[model samples]
Target chain A: MASSSQIDLSGTTYCVLTGASQGIGRAIAAQVSKMLGPNSVMLLLARNKEQLSQTASLCESKNVKVFYESIDLSKASLLEMNFALNKSLEGRRVTDFSTSLIFHNVGSLGNLAVDTARMQDVPELREYYDLNVFNVIALNTQFLKLFEEVEDRVVIVNITSLCAIKPMSGMAYYCSGKAAREMYFKVLAEEKKHIRVLNYSPGPVETSMIDYVLAETVNKNLRDVFNSFKNQGTLLKPEMTARKCVKVLLNSKFSPGEHVDYFDDE
Target chain B: MASSSQIDLSGTTYCVLTGASQGIGRAIAAQVSKMLGPNSVMLLLARNKEQLSQTASLCESKNVKVFYESIDLSKASLLEMNFALNKSLEGRRVTDFSTSLIFHNVGSLGNLAVDTARMQDVPELREYYDLNVFNVIALNTQFLKLFEEVEDRVVIVNITSLCAIKPMSGMAYYCSGKAAREMYFKVLAEEKKHIRVLNYSPGPVETSMIDYVLAETVNKNLRDVFNSFKNQGTLLKPEMTARKCVKVLLNSKFSPGEHVDYFDDE
Candidate 1:
């Protein structure tokens, strides 16, 4: 008989990535599509549809499917977000995907200054919690709900910051939010064995947040801190940090629960 | 000369304590009134008006002024809570009091079993955060606002638990909430040098929370853990724990931003 080959590539991987519009999130989107190969679907969530669409196009692959959704993860409740997800996946039959990955890259470094900034700003602090912590818990729980039953592969990658462990002078909201999110993930790590949770610190990168601080921060200490780091050229490239994150995600032998840093990996 | 018996007791000390309806909270109320002397005012807060009134009656002192407010700290915002506080102190210009203290003794160990409980229970989880974390930040900020201008004596006592540092498998909300509150206080301690913030772990004590856990918990492991500690008589009396907390609060030489444990103190 003449040699013949057939390959069925359908519903192999499904990923939900938050804050995938730009910066480290965009870099991760581009790199993850290349790493996961074909027959996969990646859901890019962001509020800026234009930037999200650009990220989707930048991460385009022949066999891998990518779609960006314009949804404010910070404001949406678990029910609303879940409804959105189900609607997005409607009739796609993506449930049979072997590996479900959730990357929480959404964060807000709001008012990066020590001058007159106070935690008493309840609305702003709550907003930080909603974006950096609550959304992740909601989406991670949703993914665990889907994958926990079938005993399939599940992974959670939280883009945590060094501020989580080291408290900043003025960034109380950001620091505590990160700490709370990491603690939640730690508890999840203990609760679920089949699921792997990694709190990854993407090191200092040249993002808009840093640029904003460099340009507009009024706190002399914070300005000097950011300017010093930038002057020293110590900030890692986003692509390099994404590569480190992907490597950590693929390394199965490493134990979960603890935090991993990109600089340490280097 | 004849001794003057008319004691001019005015503007000596003011204290705000949450969860003061019963248990260690009531014990702390009793001891704090005695420690802050006769001119002290203790504003007790709780949801149950009857229980709070009863606790106030039980803590009646000839020296200190004791009053209870029927307000659920979890439901009220910082603004509303501050209004209630000012209303409670109506006509009593106690702002000039030499010492201002805030005791955060409120926390919820809701639905202690992880069986089907998810942080997706946004309302309940938000309640946990409000009662355990944000309220403390708000109240502390208020106190700091009152005392930060001058180098006055201000102390914040957060009634923490081992679960703050030791994450429980089933009590993710409780553990992470405590961690968030502690981190917030840690940040406050660093930002303001005039304030002393202590995350005081009262140790395992006999309280309604334990009784409820012992009575209505589905998690066998958690039940066994609580029962074993109870059976071994390792649990300290609420009064003893309260005394230890008061001792730590009175020690001015001790630095701030420290996690004080009752057992460790002994």
Candidate 2:
């Protein structure tokens, strides 16, 4: 409820957020709910039921109708069903909404290794693409359908990584997946003028995924580089990052024909 | 052999091209052979044996070692075999020289509308992704393995479309495939610093594919737009485009981590 009156989310009756269980997703959900009143409905999706419940409870004070689905989006069929169910619950037919905003914040960093040999051996390379690349494409397909039907100002915010822009030795697969998703959204934005698609590279954030990567990698050089980035004051907190994302989402300044990097603003 | 002295094909040792039977593929094969000289070798891959043989004959100038494999690159096993064969033919160990250069120029286009109602009904869509997206990823994976073993520079050129960059009706599936491939290469370029990758967008060329698209769709706007581009004297001939491509390949100025669009230069 912090300065929630500054932004108007009442018009945004329905907001869909993926990976809404914790970290940035949860923060975005909370911020969005506070902006909108109780009449507005927020749909949260994640794989963990307990975590999703916790997220819903955190946003309960906003008095908004909060809903969640504990489902893995990597499974295309399950995602399709969940999408259908969410539409049905809102009492709005799948094709009716004019303005729909989708935040694709779900991602996983599989492994970190500077050596190409070791990096390729990791099983998570393919899994990283499955979750980051395939899911992004599939979900975009689903959302585009609804956007076309509505033909309103649809905004798609894909949370990308700084590694996507700059070359890094470790986290090759994760970087590749992020870079692919970034360009996918850029192409989507260019081709479809109706939708405001932004591939925002949020640099680095203090998230559990980062901790996992730091713990798994044995390279001291990579760790030192990561630590330097943190010390440089480039790393953003989840709430602060979410605030910037919301500003961009609500702002009409962007032309929707290019990729927006969060650090580029600074 | 017109103005052959202006071009240098002597140092070019090994070359690999996909979809090398007909259309731009065949044209590139023939031109690349002439540019690379008699000692160099060309590995051509396509699905049509008869067409491959015919193209091989046209590309057999200057005693260039012409090798054609009528195997579909969509088959992962066949792709692996082709890579192994190329490495053996080069007389270098399997890990000696990474894939020197790869032209991911294979794709398919069908007159299909974006059927949001039945998103899965687009059968041709899968083939588009298989040829255009998945095959590119597979080839890059193989190339990355080779890159680690060799000290030489590797280049990957992905031939994408103008439709991938712009909006077009009735070609959503085709655009999606091309867009995905472009992004994949873009990310690969970012991830692997040693390999020079070019996500080249060729805009529109005078190919049979363009004729087919024009025949099926009512949108003459693209035709008119292309015609104007031609009127402006910028529509590149196949040979001219191929020569420009070879120039980029041979020149050291164009390095790793850059994307070049033909239209952008215009």
Candidate 3:
């Protein structure tokens, strides 16, 4: 493990995030806006324009600039998206923004709307991978490529899930997606020395994803856990989780590339 | 770990395998055809109809029934495939096939056609996941659901790779997809009690994929391994790998839903 580098805020910094419309993503967006410099730029992309617009409004800062895209990373072509991103990033030069940060908070646990939810080769499971894994890789690459030429550091804070390390009964697709993501970062860490990658699994947080599990899931154990989290308020707050995740990513003391869980005190 | 169930193929059996046109898949198809009882059905599916037809021709055992489908699993709807498969299996009842098995050998490491390959979000990577991870899940589910009504057993032999467990400098997508797949099986082991899943890492074999890696990969370490394997004839033959994978999958002594690497003597 190498010494982690600090992200300089005084210089204009760019923060790119996915699933930035709601839940942990929204909370992280608001926190990032406040933590980054006054003139820092944040590009928030998600499926819902309404929620994203609402989130953009919530991240209101005196000097920080925020941009939102309602595009779907899974469906959109990487070439087209990269072209548009290159145009948007052309406005801000590499020297101007000393560092660029990325937070891939987007994740899917598959469709739990049906009580008959069980693992079988299904189209929905593939969609789940697209939402949770493919989009994450594709979008991450878009940003990494965007900052590839820059001499300054580019850090990717992958908001991984605990299920990545542990096998979940019903959410195989989601668990698998996270596992893929974690491994991807591990390779990125190994190959690209200049860039930093962090696999941060933020246990369970009070988010809309959890609400979905509680409302629609047929898996008794997961349902029980979510119900308990809701009833007992055992789930961590998204704001706090966002703060801790960002802190772990930007701070200089932590290792450059490693799997760090929120529950782990270290 | 729970006790594993042996797939009894002395009675009527059905074996469905992907990437059956060549390499380990073709070998597995031939091996399975010979192992199963007379009149047992074996469906070989892959992209190339010509190669698949040739492979199917070779699997012509005296009593074994060989079938081939050139349908693209990555693009086709699993639900539709399941519906069609259900119809196909309707002619013969569950008792007709004492044990139904699936060997998912279809995988893609992506085009190592260039030395310039490096990590960045590309459409090819997403396509690779679609081919490797998504289709495997979807197709596996279709068969698992197909055997749900029967008292007979269902076993899925997922032909995994070493890349799933280790991170490679130039092959992030392949590693990530395999990781996702291995995790999926782990969850399947946890959830599905009746259906058996084996994460069988085939290790390095003398396949076309290896040829591409050796010729085009810029990664010096991987190139060296491929070179050594190619020159020294150290790579395990597809026939040997297929035999080991099938042996582990069928025998009841092994633990249920275990990730077994080829190098592991177990």
Candidate 4:
């Protein structure tokens, strides 16, 4: 078996990352771009075209090629999504790349004001899962199909959370979405023995999401905890969390489909 | 705190059970109806009206009123569902009952032929979750809202499975759906201190679902294991598992939101 060190991005690699316009996704894109070889290709996906372009520019290098596409995964039909994804590939053969990496990072917090009992809107719930769970599964399937012939190395990362296994008072949708998405990847790991699947929980990071939670969460205790994390400067920076994520990828000591949290010791 | 022994159903009670037309659901309706006191009301919901009526008749008693509603949960709009649910209540005040109970037993196995990689159709995935997760949450929210004023005993039961926490190679949809539904209920338990929430895993049972798995499962290993369970007579009878479910409700020894399996020791 190939060692973890062999997964170095300095080789010819093909990387696809979602929600890459900002936060942890952007950080991962930038940091990984620096490590990728000259022939490597990186495709960034997000709904915000301007932000995606900015992220793409930041990730561009004299060595690696970076491209960004604005695609609203939540609203796109499966057929449309496949077309967009295929267009982004630009006819690149998956077998040509020595390494293939996909970061399933697109997700949402949904409506924090609604507790489990108040979240009765079926359409709203369906839209939330479309973005956070179904789309993730669909896109992962698409990429796995594209990379099926790549015999050497393929790694799929799910940006999971502590809520995937822990229930919060007012965050039912987010928690369930994370749990479902995480379990899907775990099932993939069991089905595909050759692929490496990791559910990386990045802890409480300093992102717009934290701000949103502080402003909207119905659970006073949960809101206070997020506030304290920020006030005490304990909340991690996206870049720092992104570094830890890449380290997990490069280290690769984790069991297949293991949930590796940012606070967990290496 | 009231003792678990005091939760005896020999009182004016309102019970709403989904998927009550057959299998464990039918068995539960039959058993619970027998225990309910005079003036108790039981509402059974399922798509098969004929089967539902059969189950309702089986559950009928001189003292209790049994009603069945045939509604396709997967296709019903939120407004339609609310109307159907309200119609089933027949102007009965939630406060009129001494006890309130809900058994969320409806679920599906989806297409066993599709593995994680093959479950790429977004529409199909959404439809699966609509029946298995979203509608469950919506209906639970509706009932909880109605029972919010019942200052006494109210029990919400989720018919979950081992697959909620365990990943199966080819059953990604079923596993993810169960995990998501279970998490939602867990969140509800955390939010609602007055209500009793229990996730009951019936274990491997002698149902048509088992036959479907044996016939359609893509994973040969999983099929063989299930077949062995059947041939060895290890698969539980629906009536026996229903007895265990009622026992759990009566014992109430489990922590709120705990997943209690049929195989678990009392």
Candidate 5:
């Protein structure tokens, strides 16, 4: 049997990716853009205009059309975000493509200074979850609505984490958001049988998120563990992990709504 | 070995129960109130003032002081709700009791009229999650903060559901909220080793929630299943399930953060 990584995605694709300015999302945008057949479209969304442009440039291909949108996913209302998404499409129909793909990669490891006992700030929690959970739900909902008549298949990927299943002591907001988002997609998968939904957990990648966790997390033990991952050279690079993620999509053997981790053998 | 249902909880207690106006919450409030020792404090919280008063009366005991607070958990900010909680406490210290307990039972099964694909209204989603997820987190945080110095063990019980672990079609909001809240409490359990955390999945109880699900859920298959349960008289009575819940707490042999379902063998 051919390995998942060796399997190539063949066809013109319409892909929507969030957090495309940085880290795994940018890498995925670049990698997948290279893989998509002629006349494919890539819509990259993030808050950083300059970085998003950089990502779009990296994804530059004569065959693949790239569009970058700079919008704070956390700040915008669902309607506003939907409008932005529609504007990005520029009158393109999802059914025109052979495949409809969406990568829900935008998330935040919230202020780790507060543990569960001290997480009493309601607005903060709301904002955090808006970015991490609610926005994902809204975008996914919009994606389904827009691509309901897709030709081949609709692939929805949530950038999930082991934290979605396992609780880390000081990371309540992050864990809960992941858990909620993961479950929402699971339900979505069950409700819409035709669409493919996967919770892809990109393991300990060397992202700015790791740096934020190291600097901000109140749990010293967890901080040290992350520090060790950094020092021990075990942290996976963003491009490498992103490659694996795309490979998983290409391989397409995993069960619908299944959580596929980077470490899990194909 | 003694069956879990046969075990009894002893000593004076400080108990905080939310959603105490009706259904499983009211039932649990009444049952647990009867078990508490002399001078135990029973603080019942819910939006329905008349119903909350009724629950308080049901939990009435000369030995146990029952206090009821009327607050819309979904509307109140964390600070406001904490103020309400403090006002209800009326200068009573949590440490005065031998056991400190909290039941996070308040949740909503959101507007099931819309499927996951149509969950586009951001404000509606926010309000739903405020009641089901965020308020629970705020209250649980306050409970931990208040009961941190209790003399004996502090027990935190989340009135969870099978939906927390299972994907229910057309019930995206409820399932996601439960999953998030369960994971939050699990993190709390891990962080605070001295406290007992239980995610009790009360099986298909005969509550207004069941009635709502039967009436409003968009998925006919799920609605049919609930209708079958109701028609076949297989739905669990609130009080009976409440008794089982108290027994589980009293027995307390399960691992910390374990999810105990009513259908599971003792």
Candidate 6:
């Protein structure tokens, strides 16, 4: 384990990132590799192995070991699968390879329609909870274990949404799931003082999930409202958001128990 | 079906309430019975059959036909169980009933110290999510069908905690769970305009759950802090809290888009 005083990137650093195949997850993995250097071990977990391999290729081609696992995190069986994955990796003799950081960026906003009637449908409700809440909890439960004997700073960044703070039209289930994850991280931060847990609301970024929702049922007027925000050119880029997040994780000035919003920073 | 001018209490008014055996849930049932009279119906769901029987007996005497189901709502299978329960109840006279309200007031806080190392334990995490989130989502999904045909006011009140807004020690999991519920309600409120969804944070109250949490914890400083709040007479009675909640539910002026905290009123 590396000491906090002598923070050396040459020492083996392990980072487990979810949703790493595309969007913000892939960008985050890229940024972490550049910042932490070649000796750091990056475990990319997502549903798409092809994209994961592409991401792995982008990192520095030195001692950087990138491992990708393709699995559906929404399933209840993810807990067992994660345990097995950890067991398999236990034999690797990587000195100073401490799991110090965890990034929870896996989430999806399935369709956007303000239909109270359809909201109750079993399939819709199940998908909402599974993607938004269950996956986050399952992954976090698994990731938190790897930091048992942490010698340096341990950071867990939960990529929540600005929508989680308030409510939005046609996104009740999505909001509910995100809010659940936000609260979970908050409590986890307070309970586990040794590790820094950040419930980060990245505001509204142009992501595939948002695009799908907007295309589906965004009211003309509502679209105009969102367009105005986007036109202002304030929406965060995935890589830029990733950098800010990593900065926060690495910075010792920011306190452990806090909910940091990107909009709040502005 | 009652006309738009008349208050419609004729619909099945399918309500799913947790912790119905005692405290706020029982009070909510009593108030709903008084408000709706013989026209209203309640599905009393809780763990204690004897206590649920008492609640049912009391509610039936008020001319509010009450049906009790003894089941642990925290179980993972609750969503399926609730769906079946709703289906079985569908056979009873299909009146012009619309699902009017959903009150999620069931949760217990295990006042354990925050151990960062053990935070990843799967069993503990599962228990936390089950008690706080699963039941809330399950009940909302199951009863949402009852509100489909009518344009009546459908309300969901998720009982939350003050700790959710601010940080607290030892009660991290409890606070996180409540926060998750709060966010869920917020999203529900925004997405479903016809249905009045409220993420209500009720400050510390004299409940069996609170008593249990306090009894187990050995932190004198924390106990002193809680004692100060109690000594200050800020802690509300269960009945008073219930009555206030009823007022919020019945008040047409209370909008659906805001997070309501009881302490804010004080």
Give the residue spans of candidate 6 off by over 4 A. A1-12, A61-63, A75-99, A110-117, A120-143, A214-235, A250-252, B1-16, B31-43, B57-99, B108-132, B215-235, B250-252
lDDT of 4 by residue, A1-266 (tens): 24333456777888899999999899888888887886888889999999999999988887777877788989866676677657766798877678888999998998898766778888888899999998888888777777777744788889999999999877898999999999998888877767888899999888899898989998876787888998999988899999999988888887778899999998
What lDDT is obtained when candidate 1 is compared to the true structure? 0.72
| CAPRI tier for the interface of model 4 | medium
Best model number under DockQ = 4
What lDDT does each candidate get? 0.72, 0.61, 0.74, 0.85, 0.84, 0.64
Looking at candidate 2 chain B, the ten consecutive residues that score lowest on lDDT are B1-10
lDDT (Cα, tens digit) per residue for candidate 6, span B1-266: 21112223344465657778998778777766666644566777788999999988766744466778777766636466556456646566434454466678787774365442344444555566666765566567656655554434566678777765665666656666666667666665655666666666666777676566566655554567677766788777777777777666555445664656765562
Candidate 1, residue A45: lDDT: 92
Index of the highest-TM-score prediction:
4
Regions of candidate 1 where Cα sits further than 4 Å from its true position: A1-11, A77-80, A83-96, A111-118, A121-124, A214-220, B1-11, B57-63, B77-80, B83-96, B111-117, B148-151, B214-218, B252-255
lDDT of 2 by residue, B6-78 (tens): 2234654556777887777777777777766445667777888899899889877665777887677655553
For all predicted structures, in order, the TM-scores are: 0.86, 0.80, 0.85, 0.95, 0.94, 0.78
TM-score of 6: 0.78
Candidates 1 and 6, the one with greater DockQ: 1
Candidate order by decreasing DockQ: 4, 5, 3, 1, 6, 2
The sequence of per-residue lDDT tens digits that candidate 5 reaches over residues A104-145 is 999899879986777777778788888998888888888778
Error of 4 at B124 (Å): 1.0
TM-score of chain A of each: 0.88, 0.85, 0.90, 0.95, 0.94, 0.84
Q: List the residue pairs that clash in candidate 4.
A: none
State the TM-score, rounded to 2 decimals, of chain A in model 1.
Answer: 0.88
Q: Which candidate wins on lDDT?
A: 4
TM-score, ranked from best to worst: 4, 5, 1, 3, 2, 6
Residue A78 in model 3: lDDT: 75
What's the TM for model 4? 0.95
Candidate 5 CAPRI assessment class: medium
TM-score of chain B of each: 0.87, 0.79, 0.90, 0.95, 0.93, 0.84
